[model samples]
Target chain A: MSELTGYLRTDGRKGIRNVVAVAYLVECAHHVAREIAWPHRDRAHVIGFPGCFPNAYAQQMMERLCTHPNVGAVLLVSLGCESFNRYALEKVIRDSGRPVKSLVIQRDGGTRATIRDGQAWIESTVAALAEAPRVPMDVSELVVGTVCGGSDGTSGLSGNPAAGRAFDRLVEAGAACIFEETGELIGCEEIMAARARTPELGDELRAAVAKAARYYATLGYGSFAAGNADGGLTTIEEKSLGAYAKSGASQIAGLIKPGDLPPRGGLYLMDVVPDGEVRFGFPNISDNAEIVEMMASGAHLSLFVTGRGSVVGSALAPVIKIAANPHMYERLAEDMDVNAGRIITGAASLDEVGEEIYRLVLDVAAGAETRSEALGHAEFILTYKSFEPIGPACLPA
Target chain B: MTTTDTRLLLLSDADNVLVARATIEAGETIVVSGTPITLPARVIMGHKLARRTIPAGTPVHKYGAPIGTATEDIAVGEHVHLHNLKSNYTATHSLDAARAGAEGQEP
Candidate 1:
């Protein structure tokens, strides 16, 4: 394994990079959020949601994001009329000892003045973040997650398996690695179950995937994307077989819901699909929503595989794009990290590409910005959804 | 890493076809399971070639997995995908109807 290093945070967690974030509580606050982030653009970013109504999922997502290890300081821009829990979110960040400030549009005399005040506060916060001392960090303290979007034929053979190799390396180094979208794991239940450390844990793993399928079926969707069909994939079962490969070869440590943190270090499944009747349209509207949940659960970085070319990055975590199709990789070389499609082209072995990805993870973890991050693609989204709390079987021993 | 006389041309390994890795011009001989067969037309990369005579409604296989079902009887070396095969999981049609209006859909 290559030697790894990172910027250590006050929480004893290692951050791949230090970034300041300006958050808009609702669509109405987006402008001020952007304005505040603009002045400190090099070190600061604007990230927010467009929803107006109060959502438990959104609030929880916001809390997790504002306090993410990568963010050294946060500025919350509230419309002052929206129902988002801005105060609670501010408190979470403040309590974590990171610099945090909330600017309410209503109290600050609307957009113009709020932007002025917000920018001033953000500039000062950025300075403070810059002055914060960086401590020594280790590889074992890292948390990573993997998700695939725009999958094609090479995904199962190359991209996902390559990510699995990286996950295996990360886990062996004592880092927490997570792979999710249980809705896509429908057909791999038996295969996934066999990898669990214990029979009981194996059964729980299968049950979690079953729950995701049932939840999606309630919405009349099968987690089958149109792109899957376009890429020579034929069935949800076939897609599941590929999607389940992202978990790597680690023994299943535990099963978890969207926001639940792993109790101990090992590979875990994140069930992003909601429980009960599907009140919300789909579990996750886009790929970034799933990425957000994994970040909230403490993944410091994300490995994103795209066969059809996805150019998205996360707001708080750096997203490493692994292109699975050789043609797609050639077309989108500027936006990708490692091209697993080389395996299909027979230019590289699966293990070779996998090792490349594994090495890339350590480099990205040690402060090398990914193509998506350098392009400032901080795409984030949170939606309305309800989840029945997990039962005892979901946690590890 | 290239194997001689063993293309191992897998198409679900359950179906009766070899998926095209590149465009196979008509009359070009390709090896599958050490058996040399000629192409009927231009078979695009990512498309499939019939491993054997495929009957209509038979499930098409790739990587030992069923990708879709055949909509018509396909002769050996014929291109498979939206034109000849359709997805059983989702109601996607053969290659033509599926790729209709969305040319260059693949990267």
Candidate 2:
């Protein structure tokens, strides 16, 4: 058994970091939330929805994020006019047995009062969190997520495949590993479906990818970014193949939406695309949005593979940045945690890099700071979207 | 998987393109599939080159998967990018028009 330990939550889930989440319910309350967490930024983080309109998806995501294993306490900051049911969110966090307090700009005075009150709450909460019980946590109890951003040709040949190998190792150790966004896995549906744990789940996998293809076709744009082309990725298909490499070669145990936690330890596919005619402009407005969705699904930490380089980290869960390009790694070494780029430079093999990533995951879980985390990069974003409850085929008993 | 001071990597035997393991200059020559071809232009690291002469409309392979079809007859050592390669599903988005705006293409 591994010797790592974490903060044990009331739900029996363990947290690698006991983060005090200062959440803004709407855009108007964002400034107050940021100011509250700004001083105690090391222990407290700011996260929120900018939407003035009510969205069930946003509400559910907020609830899941507030009660995520990594979070110790939550402070909700609301503008008192947003449609986002802040009371319902506060109730959920309170029900989860965490110390939750709310400050409405209208009810609890304006920005100055709210910021003063919120900062006081975070201070007490951080001190209280220090007394939280440290319980034994195993690698098998971990939930790991991976997303590739700023991708290029070498991403597939080096970092991505190496990440896949790492995923294989994680799954082998009985950890729940999730790889996602059917939009990015467009061209690999056939190959991905073939690796499903069940034949029925395979069909669900194919339909999810097909739905993504249709969704993007209607929008007139794939997830391809302009930086992708400059990084030497030619088409969405090519990029899809590279992105799909992060999943590794393992039997996909289940399929899930943004907030659906995996029932067991195995590989899962997260469908970030919204259900019913794509009303949302894009499935994920930014890469951080994707990481937020993974956090909602209970990912304790994330492995971000980037070829062109991305310096983003998540609020609740720590994000481990894996540099895919040797040249890019050399330039962004301070921002990077693992160098899968060594595979490209012939300094290491895929398995060697993969092993390095696995060890780093454990080390980070044991309280070692990632480069992004060390630099205080706690980026987060959430938006409106809807999803039908996952079907039975999604999780096989 | 061999990378002993190599400038190019042929990811799969089924692939018709070779990826630059490191940036290669225009005058550089590399052997591929037992045939030597001089680089027609500087190939940046993580960029692709036609490993063999790819006929127009043929699928381009990388990582042993079909990435997209070639839009023109690409010669060996020619840089394979958006100029000659197009996605079969949808058009790849680029900010060229905004760059055209840089060239004063927009008012």
Candidate 3:
């Protein structure tokens, strides 16, 4: 295996992409932050929460994202009166040995001046990050995540299983692979639980899906969309069966919540559903929210499998799109990176596509831009959700 | 045994449906379980086709697991979709209702 070079962080994590993240503390300061990041589009990304209400989960998510290994520096754009803990967020990023700065719009003479100052800070930060030393990084040191969206029937048979094969290869190589969206894994709970490394972990995996089913039930939906039905998926269970294929056939190492890094390198399930009553409308309101959760868990990049096609990339980590439906792939060829749909067409076998995905992952980690990245699709979203920490059994020492 | 033809695929031995690898128009004849049956309706690519006669209320098996329960008797080669199958997890939220709900309208 060949080695790849990455930016080394004080937290002992190696980042494939070193980004200067300009985060708006509230929606009020979004435009100013966006203006500041507009010029440094290649190396700087804009991310933030829209709500002004103080949400512990949102705050924690921001903190985790700011300190993410991929982030080399951070600029906080605060609206002065928002309840977000800018000082604490800045402190976390600073402690991570990354350059950190905060610009309060109200204190900095409003939009124009704040934008100027934020732009100046971003420029300086990017310059400083450019000089950051690169070190040899191992595949085992990487954290990869998988999610399926806009899925159709062909997704399970093609894109999802092909991604699963890639996941299996990564896991066998000692990489930490994560597959989530318990809401989509409703019917495959029994089969998924059977792959757990421990009986307790199996129970945890089963309970997570059960929670998702009950949660979606109260919401009067099963995470099934009309497009899914239009794509020939008859039920949520069928969709779940396809969605579960992304995990491959590796033994699930543990169950984790957002912001909880894997204890060791192996396959893990991210329990995204919030604990307690369904206060939040849905566990994941959109595809990006699931991507955000995966990013918080320290994923370096995410493999997004889509059948109907989705053109989304993350603010921090790059997103690799694997097209499932051959027809959709042809229609959205510009947005997709891998043609997993070829499996169904018999032009390529699952293992061939799997190897292609694996090679693309390494290439992307080595600085090859994914189709989403090339298209400048840096979509990010965060919302309110609550969760109790994982039990010791969830991640054995 | 699996078919060498790319137009249709049987995912597993336990699956009662064969997924259409390509669109099969109405009146098209396809072989399933070594028996030829004419498609009763158009089956879009990625859609399922009944492999055998199934009774209503019987759990629909795909990938060797029950995906949903059939709501009406399904004959071989008929399209297996929402019209005759219902999810066992949540009550059927029709395409219109789902679209309306996604757009913030009560359905």
State the DockQ of every prediction: 0.30, 0.46, 0.42
Minimum summed lDDT over a 10-residue window in model 1 chain A is located at: A1-10
lDDT tens digits, residues B1-107, model 1?
22212332463536565654444466877765445677655544455566777889987665565656788998765666656676444343225455567553444
lDDT for each candidate structure = 0.77, 0.89, 0.89
lDDT tens digits by residue: candidate 1, A255-275: 877777787688888878777
Could you tell me which 10 consecutive residues in candidate 2 chain A have the lowest summed lDDT? A225-234
Docking class of 3: acceptable
User: What TM-score, computed on C-alpha atoms, does each candidate reach?
Assistant: 0.89, 0.96, 0.96
Error of 1 at A323 (Å): 1.7
- Quote the lDDT for A77 in model 1: 89
Find the 10 residues in a row with the least total lDDT in model 3 chain A: A388-397
**lDDT of residue A222 for candidate 1:** 71
Report model 1's chain A TM-score: 0.95
Candidate 1 residues lying further than 4 Å off, grouped into runs, are: A1-10, B1-19, B23-27, B34-41, B49-106
TM-score result, candidate 3: 0.96
List candidate 2 stretches off by more than 4 Å.
B1-5, B96-107
| Tens-digit lDDT track of model 2 for A1-397 | 5888999888888999998999999999999899999989989999999999999999999999999999999999999988999889999999999989989998888889888998888888898888877889999999999999988778888889989998999999999999998899888988999999899999999999999999999999999998788778889989999899899999999999998988889999999888898797888988999999999999999999999889998898999999999888888999999988889889999999998999999999989999999999999989888999889998888
Candidate 3 per-residue lDDT, tens place, A258-279, comes to 9898878999999999988889
